[model samples]
Target: MLQLIIRRLLQAIPVLFLIATATFFLIHLAPGGPFHQERPLSPQVLEALNAHYGLNDPWIVQYGRYLNHLLHGELGPSYGHPGHTVNELIAQSLPVSIELGLWAWVFSLIVGIPLGVWAAEKQHRWFDRVCSTVSTLGLCLPTFVLGPLLMLGLAVGLGIGNVCGWGSWEDRLLPVLTLGLVHAAYVLRLTRGGMLEVLNQDFIRTARAKGLSGWTVLFKHALRGGLLSVVAFAGPQLSALVTGSFVVETIFHIPGLGRHFVQAAFNRDYTLILGTTLLYGALIIVMNLMADLMQAWLNPRLRVSML
Candidate 1:
């Protein structure tokens, strides 16, 4: 397991490099600089600003300099926002994003897994049909549409919570619900499918033959076997959840890395933009590695051979 983990970490270097390269060039590819909005500066002053940020250097030289900073755990300074470092911006905002993500995942699991179990156990009945229809609707509804409608219904119409601003935990509810519901729908479908397959297995038949109660068989046997697939689904679903929340965060006025990423792109804050991109990439990679470890643990053959 240690060797496997080490190998995965080592492999992330090239992936991070690609992410950094793509991010750096992609931001520059867009027209104009971060100062494009500022009152036009004298050419001498502009040159001085460029020199200050090392924008005066060639692209290769700049990339090398960025990589050096990255190696030393520096994310460089905020381009236009003086007296602020990229690390500080990230540090302040990351907790918000992570908080939102953790709540979203927990909510999805709490609701989705049970919903899946109910649907799977009640397959072809009204309960199953209702859950299927609801999950389908959730899958179809994009966050851009759902976020506003939820705000209108919960916050606007009922006055349950404020519709905008991240003032407190109350302010986070709508965004969390909007983000979690979508992923919950995905998990429901995956879990239902896995459960259905597991329920048909010979072990399930033997358990029933032993005269075990339906509840025990369903929960202990069917669900336990089905969990492998559920955990596998979680890795990619979580990555999607984290990435998709960018739109949700923007709409809900949440101060998170997603909003920062959007603002950095608009301002062409090259280092900040690249830093966020690499960070997001690393997150996805880490989730994938966790998935691999989980699969190995659940499957004895994989545990013995792969890990």
Candidate 2:
């Protein structure tokens, strides 16, 4: 397990390098500079700002300099946010994103898994049909659309909560539900499929033949194997939840990394863009590694093969 983890980490170095390299050039090659604004700066001021941020350097030189700073654990200063390093901004915002992601994950699991298991158990019944229909709608609804609809119904029409801003539990509820429901739909489908497959296996028949109670057979005997797909999906889903909250964060005025990431891109804060991109890329790799580990743990044969 440790060897597998170490190997995955080692392999991530180049992947992250490629992501960073690609993002750096793409953002730099974009039409405007970070200092570009409605009011034109004096050429002297622009030149001074470029020199100060090393933006005046040749692309290759700037890349090399950025790489050097990266190797020494520096992410450089934020162009949009003066007097703040990219590192400090990320440090302030990452926890908020992480917290939001965790809440959404928990909501997805709680809502998705049980309904899926029940749907599988009840197969062509009314409950299954209802769940299937809801899951379909959930899958079809994009966050941007669903967010405002929810705000209209719950916040605007019903007067349930504030329309925007993130602070109280009410503020968090909409965002969490908006982010979680789509993923929950995915989880529901995966879980139902996995459980259906598992329940039809010969082992399940034998367990039934042994006269085990239905609940025991389902939960104890079949659930572990049934949940294999969900476990496999969990890592990437978690990372996506964290990094993909840009829309939700923006809508809710949440102070998270995603909001900053979106602002960085729009503002062309080169260092902040690179930092957030690399951070998200690294997160994706780590999450996939975790998924691989979880998959191996769930299947002993896979674990042995990994060894």
Candidate 3:
């Protein structure tokens, strides 16, 4: 398992490098400098700004310089902010994003797993139908739509939670709900499908014949295999949530890495853009690797395939 993990991490390096190369060039190719302003600067001032940031160099040279800096753990200064480095900005914001994502992940699992199991147990019944309908609605509703509705219904209507901004626990509830519900919908469907398949196995019948209570048979005997799909789905979603939800964060006015990524892109902050991209890219790779490992552990046959 350790060997598999090490191998996967090694494979991720080139994947990240190609991502960095493509992202770096595409961003620079876009028609705007980080220094571009509606109020044009004097040519000499512009030239000085370019030189200071090493933007005066050819694209290849600049990319090489950036790579060199990256190796030394420097993401370069933020062009949009006078004195802030891209690394510093991410360090400040990523924790908030991680916290938001973690809560949402937990929420999704708590709600989704049980709902899915119950729905599967009650398959073809009204309860199952209702669960399916709810999951569909969850799938259909984008964050932009759901977030406002939650705010309008809960925050403004019932005064349940704060509408926007991030400071206290109250401020985070809506955004977390908005994010968690969507993922929960995904998890629910996956869990239901996995549960249906697992429950049909001969082992489930044997467990039932042993006089195991329905709850024990379902939760203990069947649930482990039933969760395989959900486990597989969680890897990328974990990274996505942790990195931040751009729309959800924007709507909720949460100061997270996703919002910063969008701002950096709009501002054409080259280093900041690459930094966020790298951060997300790395997270995704690591998360997927973890998921793969978990999958292998759950099904020993998969460990053979991992080789």
Candidate 4:
């Protein structure tokens, strides 16, 4: 396991470098400078700003400087917002995103897994059909649409939670539900399919013939194998959770890193954009590694294959 983890980590290095390199060049190619505006600044003023921030340097030189700063764990200043560094902004905002993501993760698993199992157990019945329909609806609704509808139904009409903003527990309710439920639909579908496949196997019939309790047969014999699909899906799902939901965060006015990342892109805050992109890329790699490890532990055959 340790060797497998080390190997994965080693492989992630080049991927991170490529992400950083591509983001650096592409962001620079976009029209408009970080300091550019409808009203032009005096050339002297612009030159001074460029020189002070090293933006006047050649692209290769700038890339070199970026790498130097990045190596020291320094994400440089935010161009759109004067006097704030990328590091400071992320430190302030990332916690809210993580908090939101964690609750959503828990909510997804709790709601999706059991809902899926229930649907599969009652396959071909009304309950199964209803679950299938609901899952389809959930999958079809994008966060942008679902977010507003949730804001309207629960926040505006019922006044159950805050309409927008993030601080207390109440403010978190709508955002978590909106993001969690949508992702849960995917999990529900995967879990249902996996459980259904497992349940149809010959061993399931043998377990029944052995007169094992229905609950034991389902939970003990079937559930572990049934979760393979969910385990596989977890890597990307977890990365999305930890990174925060951009649409949900925006709709709710949550001050998460996701909102900042979007703002950086539009505002052309070069350092901020690159910082967030690289951070997300790294998170994705780490999450995938963790998922692979977990899957290997669950299935010994996977461990052998890794070896």
Best by TM-score: 4
Q: Write the per-residue lDDT of candidate 4 for residues 197-300, one digit (tens) a residue.
A: 99999999999999999899999888888898898897778878877777888889998989878888888899999988988998889988888888887777
Off by over 4 Å in 3: 209-211
Question: Model 2 Cα RMSD, Å?
Answer: 1.7
Put down candidate 3 lDDT per residue, 182-295, tens digits, no spaces: 999999999999999999999999999999999999998888899989998999899999999899989998889898788889989999999999999999999988888888
Between candidates 2 and 3, which one is better according to lDDT? 3
Give the per-residue Cα lDDT of candidate 2 at 72.
91
Model 4 stretches with alpha carbons more than 4 Å out: none
Per-residue lDDT tens digits for candidate 2, residues 135-164, read 999999988899999899998998887767
Best by lDDT: 3
Residue 119 C-alpha lDDT in model 2: 99
- List ranges where model 1 is wrong by over 4 Å: 38-42, 239-244
- The TM-score that candidate 4 achieves is 0.96
lDDT minimum window of 10 residues, candidate 3: 294-303
TM-score of each: 0.92, 0.94, 0.95, 0.96
Candidates ranked by lDDT, best first? 3, 2, 4, 1
